[model samples]
Target: NAGVIQTPRHKVTGKGQEATLWCEPISGHSAVFWYRQTIVQGLEFLTYFRNQAPIDDSGMPKERFSAQMPNQSHSTLKIQSTQPQDSAVYLCASGRDRGDTQYFGPGTRLLVL
Candidate 1:
């Protein structure tokens, strides 16, 4: 029961550089979700994985956002050519099933310069 862990709680990136965020979900949880929280967008769903397979990614930006669940316990969100508009809190959550309540991590806050 290590809970969810997200690295570098805060990040600053150049206007056109790559930004990578990491998340380690709770053990035994099979569903992982990514979301972007902003003052304007509220909570924008990014993507999700179930049993290490991508279930949906319709909420991700078409240009530079991508997410991967390489294994059971960890996932990553990568942004290429980051821009000011990308500045937001990236959150990771996990649940036992699709309809179960998700537990959220502290989130990684990104600031694009």
Candidate 2:
């Protein structure tokens, strides 16, 4: 299989712009993971899905961030009203099942001016 695929490897948006990141998981993978990387947070687990069902997303900000795994093969993370603080590398990963080792995609880097 083609591993995980994340589109728009890089994105730049002005403050208040909305950013949408996309991820396509590996075939037959039932678990998908999302992470955000910043100097402060290092690597924060934002959300995850098991069998295309959202499992947990406690790390995501309640107001401006949302994640969706509408199907087994793909997921999306959308950030509304972006700001400079939102600039970070968003990573997508997929695994066989819960607690399994997740294979990650290259990543989508967001730059907010």
Say which candidate scores most in lDDT. Answer: 1
lDDT of 1 at 68: 92
Q: Over the stretch 22-90, how does candidate 2's per-residue lDDT look in tens digits?
A: 999999989999999999889999999999888999989999999998877789999999999999999
Clash list (residue pairs), candidate 2: none
lDDT of each: 0.94, 0.94
What CA root-mean-square deviation does each model show from the true structure?
0.7, 0.8
Best by TM-score: 1
Q: 23-95, model 1: which lDDT tens digit per residue? A: 9999999999999999998999999999999999999988999899999979999999999999999999999
Which segments of model 1 are wrong by more than 4 Å? none
Q: Each prediction's TM-score against the native?
A: 0.97, 0.97
In model 1, the clashing pairs are: none
